[model samples]
Target: MLQGVAVWAQTDPGPQRIARFEAVEGSIQFQSAADNQTRLADPRWPLAAGDRVWAAAGSRGELNAGGAIVRVGDGADITFTALDERNAQIRLTAGTLGVVLRDIPPGDRFEIDTPNLAVVLDRPGRWRLDVDPQRNTTRVTAEQGSGTLYGEGGQPLAFNAPQSREYAFRSLAGSQPLALNSGDAFDRWSNERDRALAQSPSLRYASADIPGVAQLDAYGDWGNDPRYGAIWYPRSVAADWAPYRNGHWEFIPPWGWTWVDDAPWGFAPFHYGRWEQAGNRWGWIPGPPQRRQPYAPALPFGGARPNIPQGVPPGFRPPMQHPMAPQRIGAPIEPLADQVRRDQWERTQRAQQDQHQADMQRQQQMREAQQRFQPSYGQRQLDEQRRQIEQQQQQQMFQQRHQQEQLMRQDQQQQMQRMAEQQARQRQIQQDQMQRQPMQPAMQPQMPQRMQPQAQPQVQPQAAPQAPMMRQGGVQNRGGGEPGGRGSHGGPPPNH
Candidate 1:
C-alpha cells in the first residue's frame, strides 16, 4: 500500500527522496516534465528527478532533501538531473545555488554541474555553485568540508575549507584560486533561515529528524488535541480545510501515486502519518517515528489511481493549479519575535528524546534487520561521531582528489563484480539446460577411404501378439516375460 502521503522523493532506495522546496521570496516557478506549463512554485513541493525549478529575478527557493538542504538564488534555472540511493546530481543552467550538508554516508555522492565544470562532494560540507551564462564562467566557494572541481577535459581542482575557485568555459582551463566569500546578502539570508529553524516554536511539538520542521515555525502554530498529540494548524487554511484537496496525485516508484501538497509546512505532517478532523478543524497526526522513512503516506483518494504521466518513478508533472481563493486558503504569515528558548527547550526534551530514540531504534531493528547503520541514538552521538570523523579527515584531507578517484574505482569494481556474477549464473543455467536435453545420433565422420557404412537392422524386436480371448470360458490369454504369470482372469487356474 502507498503509505506515506507526502514522501519527498521517488523509489524505495535511500537518498532518492525528492527535495522539498519552500519559496522564501520572489517569483519561482516549476516546470514538470509532462506538461511544460509553469505555475508559481509553492512551498513544500518536493522537486523530484527530471523536474525543472527556476527562480525569477528576485525570487529565492529553499529545498530540503532529507539531510541535505539547498537554497536557490535569484534568476537561476536548475534541474534535478539524477537522484538515487547513493548519489544526487543537479545541473545549473544559470545563476547560483547554496548547499549545506550535515552528513554524507560513505559510498554516497552529491554533485553539481555547470556548462564547463563539475563539482562533486563526498564529505559533509557547505558550498555554493554559481554559473555565469553570459560570461561563460563558473564560481565555487567551499565554506566547510573539501570537494573537487573537475574541468571539461577532466582536470581536477581541490577546494579545501574556506577556499574559492573560478573557472572559464575553456578546454581543461584550470580553476583559479580566489579569496573566501563569506559575507553577502544571500549569506545573511541563509544564516537567518538557519537561525529561524533553530528557534522555531514547533521544535517542542515534532520530531527533530523531521526535515522541514524549521520552515513551519513562522507559518503555523501548534495546538494540543485531546485525540492527536500535538497538531500544527496553518495560519492561512480555511476552517473547513482538509488534506489532499489542493494537491495533485503522481506516482513515485516503490510507493506509487504520491501527493504533493502546496502548503509550505506540508512535508512533515503529510509524509509522516495521518490527519484527522475534530469539530470544525483539521489536524495532522505525525505517527510514532519508525525505522524506515516513507516517500509519501497512503492518502485516501476515493480508490482511484491518479494520472501518472512519465514512464519513470523520479518523474514530474506541472503543479496542478486548482482555482484557489487566497483568503479561503491562507494569508501571509508574519514573523513573531518570541523569546528564543532553544537551549532550555532542548534541555527539557533531552530525556524524552533519548527514550524516543531508543523506541525508534527498536522499531527500526524489527522492520529492517539487514540495515547496517541506523540513527537510533540522539543527535549528540551523531555530532560527536561527525566531529571525530572531521578531525581525522582534516589530517588527511589534502588527498581528497585521490580519495574521490579511489571511491569511484571502488564503485566501478562493485558494478563489475555484479555483472560478472550475473554472467556466470547465465552460463551455468545454459550448461544445465544442455546437459538435460536428449542427445541426438552423432553422424559418423566420412569413414576412412576403404571403410563402408554398416548395414541397418532388417527387423526390430517386438512384443509377442496376445492370443485371442476365449470368451466361452470368460478368460483371455495374456503374455508375460516372467514364468507362471496369470494365464487368464485366473479362475482357479483351470487345473492344467
Candidate 2:
C-alpha cells in the first residue's frame, strides 16, 4: 500500500498512467508528467495539461492551473491535449462534463468544442456540457459568470448572467436554443457536489440533514448517513424506493407511475410537467399551473387527482411560481367563491329554461302525433275524443254566458226597487211638513189689526187654494173644492 492507504490502478483500455505520483489528504491524487502514458484517478484526483482520463462512474477531477475543475459522469471519456501552466483545452469523446474554475488566470482561457457546441470560458464560474451521441444534442448550463456558446459557424448565443441555461446541437440541423430546468440544475449540482464530497470524505448527519449535508459538506459520507444526499423517494410508491445508488426517474403518461430512471429523457417530466391522479393511478400532464380551476364536484374523468389517504401525506407541493410544478392535478388552483356561485346559477337557470322548453316541445309533439295518426286507423278513436272535447268546451262557454246574463237582470231589478222606495220616503216627509203649518199668516200682516178693530165687518181672505188633495190608498177622491164645498160643476161629490 502506498502511504499506508490502498491504491489501485488498471490500464485495460483505460486512461494512460503517469509516473511520480503524489496523494493529497486522501482527497486529491496527483502525478507528474510521463511521456506518452495516460494517468487517471477517481473523481477525487486532480489532472493537468497533457493528461488523458476516463470516468467509470462519472468521475470529475481538477487541474492545478488556477484550480479549475472538470467533471465527467457515467460512461464518459475525456482527454486533455493542451493543458499546461497557461493553456487549458480538452476534448470530449462521449457523454457529459461540467467545467468550473476557482480563478481564471489572465490571458489564460479554456475552450471546449464538441460536434454541436463550442464554449469559451473567459471568467470564473460553473458550466456544463452534455453530448448526446445518438441524438447529437449538446445541453449546457452556465450557473455563474457569463460565457459565449457557438453553433457550427461560431454563431453567437448570448449566454450571460448566472443560471442562464441553453441546449445546442439538436437532432435537427437548424434548431433554436433550449432552456434549462431544475432537474438539469439538480443533475449539474449533484455531479459537482459529488465530486467535492469524494475529494473530502468525512461528514455525517441524519435524514433531515441529508438535504443539509448535501448543502454543506463537500466530502462524501463517512458513516453511511442517510442524510448525505443519498436518498430518493419513489413519489408513486412510498414503500422505501430510495436508490441505494444513483439513477434517474421518468414519468409515463396516462398511468403516471414513475417506473423508469437512469436514462437521458427520464428526468424531463419531473422537471417540466404536472402530476395528477387519474383513474385511481398517478400520471403527469404537461402544462403550467392552473391557479383558477373551479372546485369540481367530482374529480375530472380520465386522468384525475385521486384523494390521498389520511395516513399518507403526498410529497411537498411546489409553489405556483416554480416552473416545474405540474399543472393538471397538482396545479395550485383556487377559484373565487363568487365565480363558482355565478357558474352554478347559470347552470340552474339553463336547466330550468330547458325544462320549460321541453314541456312546450312535448305538447307540440303530442299535437303532431295526433294529427299524423288522424289519417290512419286510429282516426276514428281520435275523432271521437276530439268531438267530446269540443262539446265540453261548448258547454263550458254556454254556462259562463248564462251566468253573466242572470247577474245583469238581477242587478237591474234591484236598482228599480230602490228607486221606488226612495220616492215613497220623500213623499211621506213632505206630507208631515205640510200638516204642521200653513203660510196664511205670512200672506196677511194687516189681518191682526182687522181682528182687533172690533165692530168692523169680519172679512177674511179665502183660504189658500186647497193644496192638491192628498191621495189615499190606490185612488184619489175627485170632488174637493174650497170654501163653498162645491165642485166646479156646482154639485158636491163624495168627500171621504
**Candidate maximizing TM-score:** 1
lDDT of 1 at 408: 100
Best by lDDT: 1
Candidate 1 Cα errors over 4 Å, as ranges: 1-16, 170-174, 201-211, 218-264, 275-292, 297-496
- How many backbone collisions does model 1 have? 15
Please provide, for model 2 over 417-447, each residue's C-alpha lDDT reduced to its tens digit, 9 standing for 90 to 100.
9999868965985586457434545445432
- Compared with the true structure, model 2 gives a TM-score of 0.31
For candidate 1, the C-alpha RMSD (Å) to the true structure equals: 30.6
Tell me the tens digit of each residue's lDDT in model 1 across 42-91: 55445566778888887777887655777898788988887655677889
TM-score of 1: 0.49
Q: Give the Å shift of residue 481 in candidate 2.
A: 99
Poorest 10 consecutive residues by lDDT, candidate 1: 331-340
